[model samples]
Structure formats: C-alpha cells, structure tokens
Target: MTTALWLLLYGGALAWLAPPVLRRMTSQGISPQLGVAAWLATVAATLLAWLAALLMVIGATTDSVLKGNVVTLCLELFGFSEHTPIAGRVGSIALIGVATLTAGLVALRIGRCLSRLRARSHDHARAARIIGKPTAHPDVVVVEADRPAAYCVVGRPNAIIVTSAAIESLDQTQLKAVLAHENAHIAGRHHHILMVLRALAATLPRIPLFATARHSVADLLEMCADDTAARRVGTRPLLAGLSALAGHPAVPDGLAAAGTAVVARAERLVTPTRWYVQWAHRICLTSVITGMLTTPALIQVLCHH
Candidate 1:
C-alpha cells in the first residue's frame, strides 16, 4: 500500500513536471522528432507507473485462483506484506472497478474519434478528387478555389490538394516546395500521430497534459515536415512558399502545409538552430528521455522493497 502510494505520487509528479522541460528542450533546438519521442515517452512512463501501482494494489487484495498465484508470487518476491487491512482491500476493489470503467470509456472515445477522422478524411479526399484537376505529379491535384489553400488528405493513395490561387501565387520552385511539405506529412505518417494524440486529448480533457501534448505534438510534427521539405527543396524556396500561403486555413482531418505555427517555423528556417545530430543536442535529448522513464521505474521497484 505504501509502495503503491509512492508510485502514484511519482507518476503525478512526472505528469506535472515533464511538459515544461520537454517544451524547453524543443525550443532549445532539439529536433522535432526527438521532441516528439521525449513527450510520448514521458506520457507512456507516467501511465505505466500508475498502472503498475494499480496492479500492486489489486494483487494485495485479490486471492482468486487463476491469476492470484502469479500475482502473489510476484508480490512476495518484492517483499510485499501478505495481509492487507479490510479497508484497504475494499478500497482496492473499488479502484479496480473504476479503472476498468475508465479503460472502457477511453477505448470507446478513441474509437469514435478515429472513425470520425477517417470518414472526414475520405470524404474530403473524394470531393477534392472530383472537383480538382490532376497535376503533372501523381500525388498532387489543384483545386479551383480563389483562397490559396494547400493541405494533404491521408487515404489509400494520399492526395495533396493545392488551390489554383496558390498555384498562381507561387513560382514553380516555391510550388514544388509546398508539394514537398505535403509529401513529407504523408511519408512521415504524421496523421496517425495526430490522430492518437487528438483522441487522447478528447478523451481526457480534464488532464491538461493530454491537451497540451496534442497541441505541442501537432506543432512539432509540422516542424518535422517543414524540415523535410526544406531539405528537399531549399529553405529559401520553402520559406517563400510558406509566406505565400500564410494564414492558410486548416482542413479537418488534414495536414496543411502552412497551417501550424508558421511564424515560429519561418524564424527557425531563417536562423537555423543546431541540428539534432550534434553530440550536445543528442546528449540532452537522451538524458531527458532516460531520466523521465527511469525515475518512474526506479520508484516502482525501489519503493516496494
């Protein structure tokens, strides 16, 4: 019981502390990819710590047949006391029921979110294909809208939708840069990342971390795509294309070329920071990830025995 309490505290502390540190590290020029990894790892570690603590609590109270022996053996190995107070046993049962309910709700919420997102994406892509003209490139199509929009819809054959106005606005090189950005989004499977984060955020609105992380990861993924596009087509062209498409409206269930943190991304390209491959940045990222994950595991084990 004491060990479980400590583990719960540890998880809470990590959930509260990690976001600021991860945000700072990303701002300090760690690559968006590493930033995403660090954030996701922190979230996972916190959840794992809580889950392990929950299992420990249940093990202390449960003496049922099939699972009881295994849990009892593990608890004994960890030096957990055999006898739980009557009150503690009752509390553990309640906690188990609550956890089960919460898991079911989260699963349902995520399922609904995924279903809606996929439907919207498919519908939008189908509409775009019907109305938009094909380009020289196999992956891109130009829509006849005056509003200069460019976003990619994920599907069987991922499609990049660019407005005719945008095509007219940008030079050939700039246009290619925009296409490259959309291509990067598709190639990176960024939609999957956003979908998971967004679903979690929607499901756990009370947990500010999920909401914060969803927004942060969305921005970072945009930066990741930006970096790829910049490398494919030079920064100058990419920057120009982004400028041309500034204030672009985001499409539902779509990754827009210039829809996320445009000013920050542009600044980054203009005054490039140290790349993630540098030893210094790598060390910083490695340490953050290790410390965040290891601390929780250590607490779960060390606090028990």
Candidate 2:
C-alpha cells in the first residue's frame, strides 16, 4: 500500500509537472537569477512533497495496524505497532491524498491549456495556406505576409516562416543572414525545446524555476540564431538587419516569423558585451541542467529507501 501510494503521488506529480517545466525552460528566455530561483523552488517543492508522502505512508500503515487489519503482520515486519492512533493516521492519509490530488490537477490543467494553445496555432489552415510549401530547408518557409518577421513554431512539422516584407526590407546579405538564423533554429530543434519548457511551466505554475529555465533556453536559442547569422553575413550586417526589423510584429502563434522581440534582440546584438553575455548564458544553462538532473538522482538515492 505504501509503495502504491508513493508511486501514485510521485508519478502523478511528475506527469503533471514535466511538460510545462520543459516547455517553459525552453521558451521565453530566463536569466541566471531566475534559473537559480526556479531550481531552489523545485528542490524545496520536491522535498516537501516527499516528506508529506513519507508521513502519509507512515500514518496509513499505523491506521491499518491499529484497526486489527491483517496487513498489520506485514507492517510489523517494517517496525510499526498496533498502538498507533487510527484516527490521526487516517486523517494524515486523507490530507496527503487531497494535497497531492490538488497539485496534480493544477499541473494537468496548465498542461492542457498550453497544449490547446499550441494546437490551435498549428491547426490554423489560413496560416498553413499562407506559409505555402515546406522547403528543402527544415526551418525556412515562404509565407504570404505584408509585414516582415521571423519566428520558429514548435512541433513535429516545425518550421520558420519569413515574409515578403522581410525580404524587401533587407539587402541580399542581410536576407541571407536572416535565413541562416532561421535555419539555425530548425537545425537545433529549438521550437521543440521551447514547447517542452512551456509545457513544464504550464504543469508547475508555482515553480518559477521552470519559468526561468524556459526564458534562458529562449535567450540561448536567439543567441544561437544570431551566431549563425553572424557567421554568414557578418555581425555588422546581421545587427543592421535586426535593427531595421526591430519593430516588426511577430507571426501568429502557429506561424513562423523571422524577427520576434526585435528591439531587445537587436540591442543584445549591438551591445559590446555580447561575448560576456553569451558566456554567462551558457554557464547558467549548464547550472540549470546540472541542478535538475542531479537533484532528482540525489533524492531517489537518499529518500526512496
């Protein structure tokens, strides 16, 4: 029973939490401070949940024993006795169950919301029609829009959409650079990463750690795109193009666009401190991954028994 309850609680929590956490971590772009806060929150929440589950397991075992249940024999092997308070044990179990259920439901709801939003974006036929055919390049799509933009839409048929306006606004070199950036997004499968982080955020709304992670990934992706563009068209032209396109509106959710967050992205590109910023971003991402993977392993090793 204890095993069953533990499995139910932990499994449910993870299921509820994973999608949004992963999605958010990869999406909006997070700062190091935000990532640290998120990691700490995740650690704290997991610990609290684990402790709660443990107490409930103990309480449930106690209640069964005191009620003269046959399970008492098995429980005695684990060191619990029949003199424990049945009512208190029952209450503890009930409270833990309720709390777990509530948390799980919240996570599920958030995931569902994000999923729906993504689905709506992907399924919009008008946008798909506007995007025309999928190109040889996984990231590049020619969309029929009057405004210039670039964005990566995350999914199985993930793509980057560019508008005629973008072409008109950019010189040949700048246009090539923009295409390189979009290609980088597709090659890196950045959209999928963003989706995962977004889903995780949806699942665990209370965990700002996932949100920070999401932001960090998003920022990295942009930097990656910028790097790709710089390699081809030179940083100066890329920065010029970015600056020229800074105020362009984003493509709708499902549609891909070239320049989203144009102003900030341009600023980052122009800033002399770019290399330092890139280094800091990489370090933060490393820390987040390390913390996420290590904490879970440590908990399993130390607490599962």
Best-matching candidate per lDDT: 1
Give one digit per residue, the lDDT tens place, for model 1 in 208-259.
6677788888888888888999899999999999999999678877889889
- Cα lDDT listed for each candidate: 0.79, 0.57
Give the TM-score comparing model 1 with the true structure, all chains together. Answer: 0.86
lDDT of 2 by residue, 94-145 (tens): 6557766776776677678667767865664345545565666554566666
Q: Pick the candidate with the highest TM-score.
A: 1
Flag regions of model 1 displaced more than 4 Å.
1-3, 64-93, 274-278
Candidate 2 residue spans exceeding 4 A from truth: 1-87, 124-126, 130-139, 202-207, 211-213, 252-264, 267-305
Number of residue pairs clashing in candidate 2, backbone atoms closer than 3 angstroms, sequence gap of 3 or more or interchain: 30
Residue-level lDDT for 34 in candidate 2: 47
